[model samples]
Target: MIEAPLGDPIHHLLTPEALRHPAAAWEPFRHREGLWWSEVLDSWVATSLADCSAVLADADRFCSDWRKLGNDVPDSRLTVQILDSPEHTAVRAQLVRAFRALDWDGVRDRVAENVERRLAAVADRAAFDFMAEFAVPLALDTIVDVLGVHPPEDHRFPVVSAQIVDSMDYALRPETVGPGRAARAALAELTGQWLDGRTSGGLVGHLAAHHDSGRVTTAVLRNSLRVVLHSGYESASRLLGNALLACLDSPGSLDALSGGVDDTALQELVRYAGPVQAEARGCVADTEVNGHPVRRGQVVTVLLAAANRDDRVFDDPHSLRLDRTPNPHIGFGRGPHACLGAPLALLLTRTALGALAGLPRPLRLLDQPRFRRNATLRGLERLDLGWG
Candidate 1:
């Protein structure tokens, strides 16, 4: 496949240079114009913060379920992520109820336990890979604890999660499609059993109760749980890595947190380091973004990463301000399909960062940060650090 021209933001999105330094790469294209037509991807890319917000806010004209626009979306992808209005509202409620019903105190306690244990284990080391040693394991441990499910002793969670993350990048590289599908199938089956009361009682069991009461279908509960499980673990792991790197890159950013992990500062971290980069919505009716006519059935890609850095909405948009107020970044997204796990993800990050703040020494980055080449989800694949 011939790459799109260098000037195209989509072209540089997955390149080695751009992946390592995406903020700089994206900075040049974040204009008030906000929209670009990409023949290679056959989609309209929305860049400006205002435009991206407009597209997400008006779900009536732009539908998340591209199947309406002739794309073949798999059943596995049919959770709250793709649903439109009325149905989206109901299905989202089922999942949100489960989230709200969580033992929040227990959740915080468990996350703190894992963070402290991991920090202690690596405290004596001269240097360590934060991704491998801390973020990944802590994410997995929290998943099992929160879900209250016992794995078959096969260490398959991370393996499957990797396939799913790769799948997000599949549109750019077709090779990952198969493994992504297979992993989803395997995960769906496991979640099915868990949601059917075959596994230990936790979030799955709570959701299964909803299914039993005819509040939701088996497919809805299982698929929704599966999606939550995948994103809950993978998104946290990636975001932690990204947020840490962001803190270290900005002088005194870590010191600002040494006082305490305030919600305002944590949110600034979310805006600065969120892993989500883009999401495509199909046009259900004729609409125009910033006076540019978008025909029905056309694909509109929202460049959320670019929007986060758009100077139109943020002052000194490139700087990391721990107390940046009124931050309206679409990191967890917006609209009827906003992220259902936003609260949980925030809780996990807030807890983790709070622990780091109490460490006796200053956090240090051992080397340059390395990022994954995924287009839709941008995050670090490797982060070596020393705070011991």
Candidate 2:
């Protein structure tokens, strides 16, 4: 098999077809050296686990805020992801406290209830879009409930939030940039209203309290909320879709999951079916990674999904084995910017899987799962299943 030029596959990555079948899309680059410079991305693609980890862990050299690359990122102020430490550290501490104070048991109960309620609605249908009917609703409702915020009257958060995050894709077209900025502005105003009305309890309440105490600023609170809500709202939902598809594709794994496996199995599942495909980081200073020189102002896209499948890291990397131990997958990322909602995501996924196990056995896919057209995020838009 001949390797196409590095830039040739990015257009494919922007489509649902590439997301639905990543192996086929990425197979051409499987043997490419450490970092392939993609003229399309105008950045280097880090596919090895070690290289990706190096880029993510060294924030001093590689920054999370891609705006530093000089692109006009509208509403960039509405997020902390762009801030470097010690600013990032102080703000992150406040958010971490707020997250830690959340009642996990209560959140878990609500999530499980939400999962059951959704499953009940489609339990008898001959065929249903599992993502639309179950996964998306479950994730949205859980996010609202956990944050203790009333659902927006317009129900536009899902669409807007997705667009905002999708705009971060390395393969984004010029036409998408404007809409993403507009979505960010709309979401910020909506969240501001929610924050103003809040008193105590939930995430909004905690943030309000922190703001009152003068520990966190209003801008920080708003931006942090925007980032958390957007990420929390979508990441787990994508993971849920991916994990379910993983079980369905792997024979007998559903039985093992239904019978209850330990956290190791869950970890391995994430290692095998990573949801957050790739993350872009800007080079903060001239540095060397894997002996390759990287200059300041350049962007590096770390392929997390690809790294998780690196043959050097796992035995039979392509196969999903629940018992795989010492799984050091960076599915949630690593170091300072590791996913803040990882525990919550894990709880939600475990709950969803448990609820799925309760479905009538002999489950069958009515059709192959369909993914939404996105490059930065991989998630199902429809998963048709029949159990009768």
Candidate 3:
């Protein structure tokens, strides 16, 4: 039996400062081996790629349960993200097929139009919160198009989506639950309407078609759709926001990316600033990791942000080098559960970055960006920026 490492896991490893500033906070433990406890979640946190890879690959050993993190709100399981194994495989396959078969060129054109329109609407301002003005709408519109959701122009999709995503934060205060509940309710209602055929050839249509063929049930379809919308839109939106900020923070890196740097360079940016930080998994049965005893029913959280920065895998782990090769970073995760939306996400990020870079004046970060409090889905909550 491997004895627990001595020290207050949170204090010895992660500090409040680190929790708030993950990039800086993760520097010390990036390459260090072993698991540490998180007072915030009262669970063991794995920061190394090897450990994360070990847990992710052994899905039977480490299960994924959002409820383990206290996300027991009603309709929580509607999202396919919480499912595992046989059920997970079936649902994920259906989702992947539908998502991949989407009209990507059409989607890209629509996104570009949306970005231009939104930016024009806000261009008059010298500086504004990019999250609210650009990223949120871009994400919301993309999801609305993908999910085929249609409501009044004054619809609340964006607000509700933000609330649901925000509720996943580990540091969520009691006050935050109200908004989260509202978001869940809104999503449930919207998903129900979509199920009724008010939408078109979007995620809803795919699920509905599958439901009619006995491929999926109405409940599973609704829940899965909601989960996809939440994961697809909210997380990607935050990542785009952060990636833009990262580019602005380091112009040299941005230049490399914009100057048609090779795929290797682009891969580094994705590794260095790829969004979606820590992912949660629950142990299904007793197992030993790195000679340490991992009992069944215990929760394990894989810190992607920390893992990507692990010195064992990356040199100058903290710095963003577009040319960094042998980049085995798990930005999109690994194993059977790897993100199915990776291609779409890459297209969206690439387009957004390319658009921002072409602007006449360089974009400037107006303030220290704020991060969403959720430990699992990491990204910027608000990023203020301006361009001349």
Candidate 4:
């Protein structure tokens, strides 16, 4: 029944202010009408659970093309995330096989080891930037380990990867375009180097194996690496930061999880404070959703954060409850476009959070939290934390 003030929808929706305080911006449009047309971007914003699910399911009506949104990154080859329909299905089949072969339990053990090392170094400090000290490295190392990319000791993988991820921030201003271009160029160079013989037993190696066997082209191998590095680290890093913040805020929930939380509890944590908050989709044909008529070429922004907190679906939606049952949150998305690295992400989060919970000094959030200026991937930029 609440409504956003009558104004430029895009400005209100995509600005840094809105992202930092999403609940305020979201309140105006939550349950009234599932979708609203953004005049600035000329897109329809879907702000409810049911509507988002409907749009995601009807991929025939809603297409997933970043190019249509003016992101002309070229089509030398397609990554699994960018592809749709039959092509997507084929590529996923090959990827799933390789993905299945990965030793995730082994991966979790490595993550626990890394987190312990990182935490031990900072245990003595009264306060530290969790983003830099913990979250960033946790995400970066896990990704590097998974992809099996190797480089000289002097090589800055995290720096390059951060550039690629930050450039994709939908909230990036026109002035930031220069940096974005530079980041893309850097990633391209890195991809080229990796393609030119820098391979270990990682995802890149798996793709390289396919490339050598003539199953996939050089372009496909390169683009897939680029996509994985960008998408994989961005969301997971944010989730790490967010999950830590969630624990600091909800001691009860954290205690419940730490004691002996099951998969369902972890799912609720992801639902309550997941990294990815929204997803972008474009309409392929005329369609009707929740009484609103959408035409072809129209953009629809699905608010996953809003959906997670939908009162219609979640009881006491604003509160964080680890034991909340029947929680069908779309944090990782749904259907064909769902996140491929979800299992890895879960392992990383569970391991990292579990390790932090076991720390001797109780973790506490420091003053002045900073949020990243990204509407699509929601997370803190600088989460200061302290322990005894």
Better of 3 and 4 by TM-score: 4
TM-score of each: 0.94, 0.93, 0.86, 0.89
Worst 10 residues of 2 by lDDT: 1-10
In order, candidate lDDTs are: 0.79, 0.77, 0.69, 0.71
- Candidate 4: residue 306 lDDT (0-100): 83
After superposition, candidate 1 runs with Cα above 4 Å error: 1-6, 212-215
lDDT of 4 by residue, 1-388 (tens): 2223466444664565665555565666666465766555456778789999988777677767555445565553366677676656666666676677677777778898998999988988988999988888788788878877753253575665555545545443455555656765566556767767757577766655665434545565566666666666777888878876776777666666665447887788788778787777877778788888887777787878888888899998777787789999998998788888888778778888877776666777778678876656777878888863
Query: How many clashes (backbone atoms < 3 Å, residues ≥3 apart in a chain or on different chains) does model 3 have?
Result: 4
Report the lDDT of model 1 for residue 166: 84
Q: Which residue pairs in candidate 2 have backbone atoms (N, alpha carbon, C) closer than 3 angstroms, thus clashing?
A: none
Error of 4 at 349 (Å): 0.7
Runs in model 4 with CA error above 4 Å? 1-5, 9-22, 66-73, 151-172, 198-200, 212-216
Best by TM-score: 1
Screening candidate 3 with a backbone cut-off below 3 angstroms (N, C-alpha, C), the clashing residue pairs are 63-282, 78-223, 169-374, 265-322
Kindly indicate the candidate among 2 and 3 with the higher TM-score.
2
Q: How much lDDT does candidate 3 score?
A: 0.69
State, as a TM-score between 0 and 1, how close model 3 is to the true structure.
Answer: 0.86
lDDT of 2 by residue, 20-63 (tens): 77666666555556776776677887888899999999987898
Residues 1-388, model 1: lDDT tens digits: 1223345556667876777665776875676374777765688888888888899888888999877788897887777777776667777887777777879889889899889999999888888998899887787778777788875365786788778888876667789999998998888888887776655466876676655435456776677788888888888888888887887778877777777789888878877888888888888988788888889988888888889988878888778899999898998888887777777678778777777777888889888878777877777788888863
Model 3: which ten-residue window has the lowest total lDDT? Answer: 1-10
Query: Candidate 1 or 4, higher TM-score?
Result: 1
